[model samples]
Target: MNYLNKLERKIGKYAIPNLSLWLVVTYALGYLMMYMTPGIISYLMLEPAMVLRGQVWRLVTWVLIPPSTGNIFFYIIMIMLYYSLGTALERTWGTFRFNVYIFGGMIFTVIGAFVAYGFLSVTGGLTIGIGYYVTTYYINMAIFLAFAVCFPNMQILLWFIIPVRMKWMAYVYAALTIYDFVTTGAVGRISIAAALLNFLIFYLSTRNYQRVSPKEVHRKYVFKTQMRDAEMRHSGGVTKHKCAVCGRTEKDDPTLEFRFCSKCDGNYEYCQDHLFTHEHIKRS
Candidate 1:
């Protein structure tokens, strides 16, 4: 986690904001291609053999392949759900960490494809179209699983009617995934493991487990509600923004603009004059 923090500090500015929206747009484009020019879809798959043969575009273009195509209604619903989940994760984890998690899964999936290809070649097995087995399906599953871990008790309407908690859904997902891995071929198993490896490595290894405990979650929820009520009660008296450095608020200078510092360790804000000059706050 410390290493990740350092890396984020160095290159976090390059991380994409609203990456989920772009991903959804990419899927939409892929869907359009599927309907308009179906043959082009094959050229976009992450086929190792094709890539090695100098069709290197296949390596990156594969991400544009939509996970599934059937009922348009369900597909739209799935895209919206994933977009919400991805946005929540990006907000909670910050852009850089979310980007690492997503890109890490993609890199692993690419490696897994090549690994599977090598194994097949060595074993005198079929090697054509190996990329067909690998898709963003498991990557989407990883996003959902990560969200479940962070907000286990969050409830949503199941099939737009029955209410269900995310943890229960996660359990069902895990069970189904395990069943599929056990029943499917080597390629399928590798694809699943590769895509989900990022979740296991990032969340399980670095997350503060205590923060996810039922008691902790409940306590935080109560505290947040209390703070919200207090803020509401004092809303008329309190200023909306304040500068941590200058100790100034909009009440002090109506023309002053305040902004939160992304480089700071905590939620520190600054007024326009000191925004660039103030030293960032860091916890030891």
Candidate 2:
């Protein structure tokens, strides 16, 4: 963990990973469905338009639909890969932001589908092939891109031995996404739109969103507290000096060290740990 994270933890704050379980469950279920028969995914699922008509399950289950279910083993491999991607996203974006990336992509694609429907209704439905034919995979890509932009030098295994920089990963994914959008075969294109939407939304919402300097964040809260305590200790009053433990008093200085009493006196000194150095006090 970094310093900022440490500080946040010290303050009893935390960033939770949001909405990742759904992706895991949805895709895993799809993988299971494929084992039973081929084209089962489509059969169990309805086209977006069909869903708009009445098959409401389409609206939700649509996300579980994988790019392609190759073989039993192949889907297993893909599930493992996508899960790795999911974990990376959770760590990079705290729960709150990651959910935004996910739902934002879903929402944008849904909007695109409705918009595409409006156009198709005017004329007729063109074969955009399977999926929404919109770039949705990129929603995921854009989030990774944001993380890469923030931490370019971060390293990851391309495939075990081939060490790669996060920046390269983002670039390579972005190229594939763009190529898929332009080319005829749309493989996981809806994901591209979703990823792009993540980028746009984050960029727009957090144009001013930059990591807070850890020092500044600490000073603002922690240092402010220390200052308040220090001020109270120095305030003008008939300051008394006596040890509640031994009643030792320095009459001349009236500033002898005496730790506060947590019991009877409620304010006399001879702290619970006299031998243990207390850094919170100022010595004459």
Candidate 3:
């Protein structure tokens, strides 16, 4: 099995459901805060210098900052677009994998912030706030990129007018990102790289792995053969349902009702006559 499959088996249960809704809610709260008390936002930025001085809440509160603060109409449209993309990704990738992708991007962004802070502190004095540059903007971009990769041919209206495929949109965005990275400063480059690192890793890992590849086909064949063999063994050689207590099966008495004991140590079935009377089995 793949590493992701192993991880899903182990910790998938802890994944948050409807994570996209929560992200939208955070953006809404940030917008409200921006309109109400803009000054408070300075305290919520992901400033590593501030964190070292004990303002550690900046690490998390930075995510609450909206990607943009201009043009309310565009902001609403952007939020709706991302909400749709995120929800679709969650449904396609499953909650746990989607959680990993998002949280991975966020974690990488945090690390990038720290790296940029260190670089600036060593070369020049801490000149400006790194938090301003290292925001969730790239993280949002990563989401769109992932959606594009997953549904490249899916069409959506561009500017609510022209219909365009996801791949075409992704290409445009990618070109813009490349241009931005080339023209921007070191901190901006680092932030962009960090934010999209998750998508990069995911794309590289899955690019060559197709759904109907030879390995997958072999796996399915083996699974089906095993299941068929088990079914044949059960049908041709053994009784379908057998009683552990009375050693009786459906063949012995067609009307016999059998049930596996829930409290039994193992696969112990009993006829209705002995089901309630037999002591529950316990394994050490």
**Which regions of candidate 2 fall more than 4 Å away from where they truly are?**
1-18, 44-46, 71-78, 127-136, 185-191, 204-284
- Writing each residue's lDDT as its tens digit, candidate 1 over 1-284 gives 89899999899999999889988999999988888998998999998988899999988998988888889899999999999999999999999999999999999999999998888889888888787888988999999999999999999899999999999999999999999899989888888889889988977786678988999999999999999998889887688899998799999889999999999999898999989999988899
Task: Say which prediction, candidate 2 or candidate 3, comes out ahead on lDDT.
Answer: 3
How many clashes in each structure?
0, 24, 0
Which segments of model 1 are wrong by more than 4 Å? 207-284
TM-scores, all candidates, are 0.73, 0.57, 0.72
Q: lDDT of model 1 at residue 139? A: 90
Clashes of 3: 0
lDDT of 1 at 169: 98
**Consecutive 10-residue window with the lowest summed lDDT within model 2:** 275-284
RMSD per prediction, one decimal? 23.0, 17.3, 20.5
lDDT of 3 by residue, 1-284 (tens): 29999999999999999899999999999989988998988988999998999998999999999988899999999999999999999999999999999999999999999999998988995736898887888899999999999999999998899999999999999999999999998988989999999999989887767667998999999999999999888788478788787888988999999998999999999998999999899998
Q: Point out the higher-scoring one by lDDT: 1 or 2.
A: 1
Tens digit of lDDT per residue, candidate 2, span 1-284?
A: 25434655564244335355567677667667766665765644425567666877766666666645567666665556566666677677666556656776777776666555555566665523334454324544565676777678988876567999988987897787678767743234443454477676665664553446676787688978999988877864434565544555555345455556343323446633451443334334
